[model samples]
Target chain A: MKSLQELEEIRNKTRESVYLRKDRAGIRVVVGMATCGIAAGARPVLLAFLEEIKKRNIKNVTVTQTGCIGVCRLEPMVEVYLPNQEKVTYVNMTPDKVSKIVSDHIVNGQPVMKYTIGVDGR
Target chain B: MEDLSLHILDIVQNSISAMAETIRIAVMEDDTNDRLTVLVEDNGRGMTEETVKKALDPFYTTRTSRRVGLGLSLLGAAAEFCGGSLIINSQPGKGTSIEVWFPMSNIDRPPLGNMTDTIITLIVCNPDIDFIYEHSTPGGKFVFDTRLVRREVQDIPLGEPDILEWIRSYLSEGLNEIRGGA
Candidate 1:
């Protein structure tokens, strides 16, 4: 039975041992998770980002969620922000698309234009 | 909502938008009573009596950008279809509590979906808010609180990849053990 206390202990110990680098000035991946997004199946999309990050052992990238972006019709949206760069908003995101975003955008510094709002004509 | 967890995510958004500082979500499955109950309580800006009355109405909404707020209404319809009821208790300054109960074996009752993602996503999205989630079955119980993690890792973000992954596995493992893999 891993209690909350035990989990905290694990976090504390790992925090010291891992020694995370200070250069997280990396990309930020934000998923829309408002009522509209949730209704459109954003949970799996968010989980997919986390899963891909762990699977690839990627570092410096953070996955987060936000409320409605005011475009409910183009929901399940994701926005990636790199330091000192314009935000690339991806609409109608899915679990499979998350991997490509991670590898092509986060790792290679190129956004997948097809899934983005700029090309979607929304 | 397709599942109880999705409904929970939707309901919690209301609380978050209300600027809730502490939110508690409880899920209880009682075999003896043949009921599955979900309670989401939050110390947020509670709605007025009139607003609460209209919350279950599909046409009513607070947002100006949208014409409808269907989250609560959908959950209410789902509960009613499963021979269950949904209740809301609130005060303007106090807090809000929503209790939903459904028949455990009802054909219309939706299965509880991926709760692990629900919790992790909530925490990751709203890093400042504190969440307490409890799941209780006839066999055992599991409790997760953000205060504990925050205390230990004071500076680190909960959205950190390693920490979020740990939290996810911990929730799934705890639920699996308590439910004895169903």
Candidate 2:
């Protein structure tokens, strides 16, 4: 029932939003949501970030999506692209982990190494 | 097969891949009652009621690429596992609507994964089709649609080199706002 006009407002206003904020350099969280990723539950991971960013009142951190990372079995995977830091890959992600990642990594400047790729602390 | 939410995303994508012109996705969270709901609708090439029933079978597949179609099967499994249910209804010549209900307390419920990639891939692979994605929490709503984006910028193809990057960010920011950005 939504219209094109709503999307137009978005394209116009936010076209320069992210770029303008680049001077501040926010954290970038990319989650895989390919057919494989979706089948593995990437939606919650994305929402987790949305909730955390708002709850913590954090700025500059943006969450996005990516295609198949070639590891379907370990999906719901999240890659944290921190400002000026190496990309950290986290596997088997869930809504719960999203909070930790937000609080520890984005806000506290400490990545949840235990949840990062290959650790599988599950 | 693993997470319910992921399976839900896959089946929804199947509708998009089937050339749905208008796709609707909704996520609702009720913390007070402790529940979440996801619903996806599409006005695309719909299946016969018979086909709709069979599509849920793990071994039934219309695709020639593989032996089976796991999208719906996984969704069925995820829904059942999470103290929830998935209902798929379709009519020949009409469209399909898939609904997933999850008890937010279900420990096994899969995470709500990335949607940005899902929309982008759908946009890139099916340039001809349009997608309307909407996600709403108790607080607000986020929506992304290709048709609207395409209409606004006539000169630039969203898939084009420079525009693609901006388009991607626009989607992320727009979605973030829908979810009540900070």
- Candidate topping DockQ: 1
Candidate 2 chain B weakest lDDT stretch, 10 residues: B155-164
Candidate 1: lDDT over CA atoms? 0.86
lDDT of each: 0.86, 0.69
Q: lDDT tens string, model 1, A1-104?
A: 44456556667666753456464476788888877899898999988888898788777777787878989889899989988889999998888898898899
lDDT tens digits, residue span B1-182, model 1: 67999999999988988889999999999999999999999999998999999999989988887778888899989999879999999999878999999999999899999888799989888888999999999889989888888887677777767677668777898899789886
The candidate scoring highest on TM-score is 1
Docking quality band of candidate 2, CAPRI definitions: incorrect
lDDT of 2 by residue, B75-139 (tens): 77777876888888887667888887878888887777655755654454445566677776666
How well does candidate 2 score on lDDT at residue B5?
38
TM-score of chain A, model number 1:
0.85
